[model samples]
Target: MSKSLNTLFAALLLSSAGNVLAASSVDLTVKGLITPSACEPTLSNGGVVDIGKISAKDLNADQETHLPSQYLQLGVTCDAATLMALEATDNREGSNFADDMAHFGLGLTNDSEKLGGMELRIVDPIADGVSPWIIGLQNGSSTWIRSYYFARDNILSVANTGGAIPIPVQQFTSSLRINPIIAPTSGLTLNNEVAIDGSVTLTVIYL
Candidate 1:
């Protein structure tokens, strides 16, 4: 082969080798755990209740269940400072006397920001033979109930700047009160014998 042709061939081979080396690549990997198992609510009763069994009459007594005073206090812990709003719901599948009220209070760490606000909701199943009721609040003042219906749903929204925020890396406590009402016709006793096995799902949106 000619000298020029040989030089050209050598150059082409070098370029091809460089291209091969440049084409080399590495495998990339990413992983995480989403929606790890949620912790179940610890029932007032000793037995652990499944989420599905929350509204069954078999679990509850014939009488009404009064809201626990302790429920008026709830607390949440997180890695960073956050603003929280909450809503409460009942799974009263098809009872005639399923009614409830939820009260809430927010507490934050010393250096934390002020509370933006919160909302609460109560619901009654249509299959139940009673009417529904609603109560709400905003900026720390309670609002009047607008509607009442049997076996319907109710909602309340509350907001307050009066509450303080906690310091960074510190834990804070909040509280809520839930009261259930029963219809007179259901023959349900208001003796507070009722049992409640429900979960309160709280969604905290950081502002």
Candidate 2:
């Protein structure tokens, strides 16, 4: 039986070699572009937004408490004029009380309840010392829109005045505003001191 099976396999191989075979092998390619220009992104105040200690009595019990907005200086410097975009990602995912992707989580309580959320907005963008409009592109989308809200996993770029296309820039600066909102205390267990543990990472993507 083994000999018969081997003979059948040999006959099939010979027939395959004689006929036009269907994809006996495929070509694999790894393609990418390496540019000479490099960009560095930086945030003032070490990218830390301190909400400070809050009194339990000062918190709202029935509705969400909106804290005062804070502003941070965001700057990006490139070795040469390059087209790039800034991407934001939530380091502490799935902890925000809100259901919106633009809201970043402030961590959870000891009882595992979502603490709160924070929103980031990019405003007053200046590219190469000229005021320019800021545009954002969401993941898996090709369209770019004029937006101020910096959503998670979104790409933000700068465009010239009256232009919708993103342009190459060497220096970019903007004011990043943070609006923090705390969930009502009625649903949270606050027997112990809870820290505001929200962290987000800003990355530079070369276009």
lDDT of 1 at 52: 26
RMSD of each: 19.5, 6.1
| Lowest lDDT block of 10, candidate 2 | 17-26
lDDT of each: 0.32, 0.90
Q: Stretches of candidate 1 above 4 Å error? A: 1-72, 93-170, 185-199, 205-207
RMSD of 1: 19.5
lDDT of 1 by residue, 1-207 (tens): 699999999997987974555555699999754432232222233322222222334323445333222333334344443333223433322232322233222211122211111223233311112222222333343443332221113333222222222112213342333433322213433233233323344443232
Give stretches of model 2 more than 4 Å off. Answer: 1-25
Writing each residue's lDDT as its tens digit, candidate 2 over 56-117 gives 78999999999899999999999999999998888879888986888999999899888999
- Looking at candidate 2, what is the lDDT of residue 168? 97
